[model samples]
Target: MNIEIVDIVNKINVILVEEFEVDEDVIEAGKNLKDTLDLDSLDYVDLVVIIESNFGVKLVESDFANVITFQDFYNLIERKILAKQQ
Candidate 1:
C-alpha cells in the first residue's frame, strides 16, 4: 500500500485523540510525544500495537528511541511502510 505522509499523520492524530485523549491542537509535528502527549512506556507499547494493527508495520524497540516528536513518528512510520513495500 502506498501511503502519504499526511495520511499517516492524520491517522496518528486520530489515534492519539481517540486512544490517548490528546487534544488535537497540541499534536503538532514538532511537539514532543512524551512532553506534549504524556506518552509513557506503556503508552509506547500501545502505540506500537496500534501502529502494527493499523499500518501493518512492526516497529522494533530501536525505532521508539528516535521518535521524540510527532514528525519523527511520522517519518518512522513512513520509513517502515516503505521498507515493507520493498
Candidate 2:
C-alpha cells in the first residue's frame, strides 16, 4: 500500500517517542508539537535530527518554524519527499 501523510506523521511520532523519550499517548492529530507535545527547544532540535535520519531529508529552520500541528509536520515531510523524488 502507498504511504499516506498520516503514515509520515506516525513515523515522526514514533521518533519522538523513541528518540526523545516522549510519551505516545499524549500525541494527537490536532496537537501542536511545541505546545501540546511538551517539546522544548532541545527536544525540537533532537526531533530535527530524528526527522533527517529517519526520512533521509534535511530539516531547515525556516521549514520547521511553520510546523504547528501533526498535519503540518506530515505535510513538510511529504513535500520534502516529493521534492527529492523529482
**Highest lDDT model number:** 1
Report the C-alpha lDDT of model 1 over 1-86, residue by residue, as the tens digit: 68899999999899989999988999889988889988788998898999899999999899878888889999999999999999
lDDT of each: 0.90, 0.80
In angstroms, how far off is 7's CA in candidate 1? Answer: 0.6
Instruction: List TM-score per model, in order.
Output: 0.95, 0.84
Model 2 worst lDDT window (10 residues) = 1-10
C-alpha RMSD of each candidate structure in angstroms:
0.8, 2.0
What C-alpha lDDT, on a 0 to 100 scale, does residue 60 get in candidate 2?
85
Quote model 1's TM-score. Answer: 0.95
Model 2: CA > 4 A from native: 1-3
